[model samples]
Target: MRGAHPRVVLGLHRSRYERRPLTAALDLGVRAIDTAFNYHGFTAHQRLAKVAGDLLPRLTLSTKVGYFPGPDGAPQHSLAPSRLLAALEQTNQALGRPPNLVFLHNPEVSLHAPADAAREALSQACEALADASRRGWCESWGIASWDPTPLPDLIDDTTPAPCVLMVRSGLLAGIGTLDAADELTARWRPSAVWGMSPFGGNAEDPVWKTVDPRMFLQEPTAEVSRIQAAFRVAYDLPSVRTVAVGTDNPAHLQEVLQALDRDTDTAMLLKYRKLLRERHAAINGSEARP
Candidate 1:
């Protein structure tokens, strides 16, 4: 999962039919691909029915939960663990094979420990996952979150050890530079680190502007140049175990890989990204219709 081909982390929502970008990435030599149980549309679940086994054999399939639509526009985690279990069954049914890893979608609650005495919330999250596994939904499970600090509480006491992973704010952390903290680096090293944002931070980043708005399209915005520069710096020292770049577009992915091939330092990317982001933010802010 760490070595060899370039990893592709795709936020697959809803169907396998919409998997043209993923199918193309498979053709283009992309090895690792990600998805979630909650990404919904039309084709996000088709992989289960069609892509399982044969196509699934050569790739890493990751699915997650903890984020879904509710009646009002509020972030709700009130869905029962039974619902989570149902999602997993659906995922398995769709893929035709077991998912390699299961993660908590951008959980409003910390995948790492929260600042509050939220042990009850944490227990339910893992319990739901375990329940699914007991029911034969996945092969293994892991956590993807904003930071690793809060993760220890969840891991230190699991019945059967659970693998842990980190998810960073694609735009804010850029590339999770802090992944190298001596404490975590020693104990809870991640199997893979989710880059989460190719737009550098919410598709609003400048480097992502060149592509269409397709969820699967991964076009490079002005920030793409900066991000590669950032990778050059981050990858130089080898801070994280693996990097998951979301490639949703065939042409957009080409642009990203070509960009990475051009430059190799993430620090340099960050330097330029600062200026680019500021400019983009100002433009959007000024054009506010209000």
Candidate 2:
């Protein structure tokens, strides 16, 4: 049996909704799972309940709400307080209990309004989730954003802070997005920060073959593959407390756990961040001059 590894969360974004993997995760002491309302064709929660309702109590469950089934049957994003609250109610029913944490999924997607209106819309949506938490709908609430650039500007005294703020992390994460995530973290001051999509949604991307991520480790080892190295370094790219990763293979989950034991080269990471900033600055400078 493996010891508990809380820092690694099993994300179900690309999961196959299999009971074996959920059981495998618990056996490996990976007790956290992240999912969203619209995943698996809006049936993820129901599927999970049917497949592994018994195992859920042993896991720290987190989910997101904001996307709903549209009139056309496709999922549509919204920040309406009533819609959000209704989804939270459905989430509790579908999972057979409240989630440990619930995030307002991708509010930026619907923030096409002017700055003031956008701020109001976001504040109301957050309040709905906050109220749900207080009412025992969930232990806590959070914000999970794929693009956090617009969020920092809209936050103010009236905006409720989330218990957790989840953003994309890893070698594939852009410098701009990383900087924005850091800024949002500072502004919101969440109790915890989480990183998602460390491989940018696909570990098999050709880009992984070109860059050797082991260089970011304090002491590179032949035992750690490039994928493991990349996953390990994601923790520091934007400085997150925990990361949400997805894999159905028990062997792959074990590989991720092994990467957690290796130390990251903070100095090397700082230098890389600096290089990225300089490159971004140069590109903007050239564009401004033209």
Candidate 3:
């Protein structure tokens, strides 16, 4: 398995939640820990190993690179050969082992781009990764895409092809990861699927902290408060199977796991959807009817 997934591994560089969740996953015997090269703080994975020594053996350990915004949070993606080499060396120090898999985090170019941007970027990244792999920096390389529109374009480009997808499948834009999954269903398959961000693309995660009074007006109170319920509702759609959670504490982790266990039936989802829609319509009517 690859590490550095948005959902599970989490970019622990600066977040307080990194330590506890990483510890929980390790204590549970999870071997893979995803991190990003851009993540600050010295040797994040090494720190994890020091804390959870016994769990290291099972860790598949993955790290990513290509962007970082100065403290302001600006982003960048650079796959230049020398830059990758430097990042590889830093990764080795952090994990104390060669990474199992590496991905180009939200590449600047796309094989699926209407223009040649992604195509060119894909080509350059593939070549750079190949050379890095031979030198023992990584064992494999893949791509992650949240957009469904580009899958076709990526397939058409041949050289340095994408082998995996770190997809954000069903969380947004309906239940279609068509951009990442469909084309790959044929010639290749994904190595890992790191999930992230809770509320569609809006990233409104408070839906998890507590049953905010605001959401109560949108649906049944009981359903609104169930985080595990929301997770199942989110994960149940066939579009999403692999998920990653970035809870900063165990109390939340417990909620997430609990929800994962509660089976979200299609009937329930349909009912919930209906409830939300009816609530919305009622609200709109009351406001519009004068």
Candidate 4:
């Protein structure tokens, strides 16, 4: 089941856990927070968990397991179900509360291994997460991956189906070619689909980095700010149930809200979607269809 909160989720991964930004976002009514166990030396999740303190019940807390802080404070990926279950225990012990949703972070690693081994590993992990949910460690379990192509294989349905799929979806970084063509319709769909990186992942683009968002709405021509164009595309997708934006700057968060609050121009969104589809198809050498 999806939570009753704003469709925009405040991602805590890049927020550095600064009290001011989180408090300000919460004040602005951002009730859903996304974080991971290895983010910022495993401190980001705890910091946000601490800051929310008494208000935890009112907020939706989603986190991921499978990556842990290594000896040098870098990430060490481990998707073993036993390790994941232990991680959840540690997470609860640290936060003194249960997370609403827990995800298997980047289980795509399993696909790189031998086929038989990969299937077993992924299946075991999913089963373990479902067990954790039964024990009240988390309400539901899902898989978060950069490669959505393997989602069908990972979710064999022998285990409990995932409630969400947190993946990349935006303009410029158009959802994968198959997704652009809407070919994954028959796969196991999630109850809540979350999209990240609305700015096309091009940090150096002048339009995304420096252009005023208002310019996109004000311009009479076909030009649109990269951020606005990206956000609009994400908003228009029927599969994406919510969008996650990460920033340490409270002011920027408010600005993002302003962009989201404006009415989405369906005609404009459709136009851009068509252009993006063709562009992506050209790059992939696939026929672009409406």
Candidate 5:
């Protein structure tokens, strides 16, 4: 798979029931996919296995570990070597092949749990992933989270370096505002940023509905759609190499691809960034710009 910047990867987080759209995306030039071990009741891997035989070699496949529903119907979180290895083997078996990239899903558990306990778990997880990379079960590994608090610790020289970091990011508008993208860029330039939740995880949200692209876009309303406006900001960030945008509808995915291609122009991206920061600052009543 090519490591091209400012490109989009098809996310399989919400496509538990459909696989045809995946092949459709590939036919439409999408070269990467992002999936999680526990997405859709721990069955997403099984579904992907059906198509892995023919298409996996041509795609950059990514999946996550760290959280999955147990037989008792409760979610289990473990970074112990045995458990982590077992999960990896199971996932690889389910997919009929190993993943191109693997991630530690929702590592924010480190931020919420006791410091010492969290570090122990994080350490074990890193060791397990390092072993996976060495054993040929996975090519590369990283962490995926909406929170950035634990990232600095995870990326320290003492730990196993992550080749990719997937996090929640988008235009954000007025909701779920965060300075993580800026912080991440400043501190960790080594890891490629893979952005998730490009449309704030809800494309039809009211916040975006109220936004008028005429205020920022050079061509006013005719140049970009609301969805494109949201994605442009994250894609323009220097550290962000890829943004995962998924849809169950082939037509919608095509539209998203068109938006990415059109809105990523350098001139429009600069204007969009300026306007988004100004709008966010006004909403939060802060003079500081992200």
Candidate 6:
């Protein structure tokens, strides 16, 4: 079986945190919302609670931690157990309820310590989230890695496996990142895998104009917009079960949801991956020749 149809999550990374979008999402049957503690200047949770508290009960909420406000007002990534626990507490308080899932956001940014120390730090951080879940702070915990290349090596039998693993997805995702994400999935065996940044942060980027993503669809057609095809194909790029996408426009969100019914051409996806690998190897070989 091909498994259930992929789901779309309304990501708040670039959201205005307004009630209109939230209500539109619900109206479109998009009940899941993804946000990070550092979003909207670290006030996303509070703003969401204030603006759409009535609708929250109908949404499946997920949030991220790890980036804390620095002394200079800039954000700093940390893997300290204490900080993770504190952030989770604050997250619960700010939202007025526990989130359905809490992700340790972008821990790779802080894994510069030596291998052993880094492993220890990552384990402790994961344990902190797991512990918080045990205490009912959140329903579950996960890891959301923007760049997951460095994570697989640090994972061992003792490392706590997350319930979910969220990584970058779509055509813009590099070969190395796609491979690393697959490796991490193999090692951790999370219950679910999610893809994010299908448009690579901006759907209007000029690159979108040059590529015909419908080529990757099983039944390519001009009827489907390039953006919709790109969003549809993202689910197969890394084989994620859910994709978190950002858009304030209700029509755009609805168009994206329509993509879930379009089947991707798996053969085409495999060929593209092979081409990506060959091109990557050729570039590396050329650089080494000097």
Best by TM-score: 2
Count of residue pairs whose backbone atoms collide, per candidate = 45, 0, 14, 0, 0, 0
lDDT of 3 by residue, 1-290 (tens): 22322333433434452345666655543435566666554345566656655555666666676664445665555656567677777777766777777766666332445556666665677678767777878887766555544545544436465444555533232333432454554445454444544445333456445543222132334543445445545553323445644445555544555444344446555554455445555766742111
lDDT of 1 at 262: 38
Let me know the TM-score candidate 1 reaches against the reference structure. 0.63
By TM-score: ranked, best first: 2, 6, 5, 4, 3, 1
Sorted by lDDT, highest first, which candidate order results? 2, 6, 5, 4, 3, 1
Per-residue CA lDDT of model 1 for 26-122, tens digit only, reads: 7666666676654544235564446444667777777776665557744455325666777677777778777878876544354334534345566
Off by over 4 Å in 1: 1-6, 13-19, 47-54, 68-75, 78-80, 110-117, 130-136, 146-161, 169-171, 174-187, 201-204, 207-224, 230-238, 258-290
TM-score of predicted structure 3: 0.65
> Model 6: runs farther than 4 Å from truth?
1-6, 286-290
lDDT: worst 10-residue window of model 1: 211-220
Give one digit per residue, the lDDT tens place, for model 4 in 1-290: 22234778877766667677666777777878888888877775567667766667767888999887778878888878888999999888867789999988988755677766777788788889989999999999887766666555544556455688777665444545236223333455567777776665543467666544332343423344455545655554534768888877766666566555455556655665677778878999999876
Model 6 clash pairs are none
Screening candidate 4 with a backbone cut-off below 3 angstroms (N, C-alpha, C), the clashing residue pairs are none
- Give the Cα RMSD of candidate 1: 8.6
TM-scores for candidates 1 onward, in order = 0.63, 0.96, 0.65, 0.81, 0.82, 0.95
Candidate 5 regions exceeding 4 Å error are 1-6, 153-155, 173-178, 213-218, 237-239, 263-290
Write down the TM-score for model 5: 0.82
Task: Tell me the spans in candidate 2 whose CA falls farther than 4 Å from its real position.
Answer: 286-290
Range of the 10 consecutive residues with the lowest summed lDDT in candidate 5? 173-182
Q: On residues 189-215, what C-alpha lDDT tens digit does candidate 6 reach at each position?
A: 899999999999999999889999999
The residue-level lDDT of candidate 5 at 159 comes to: 60
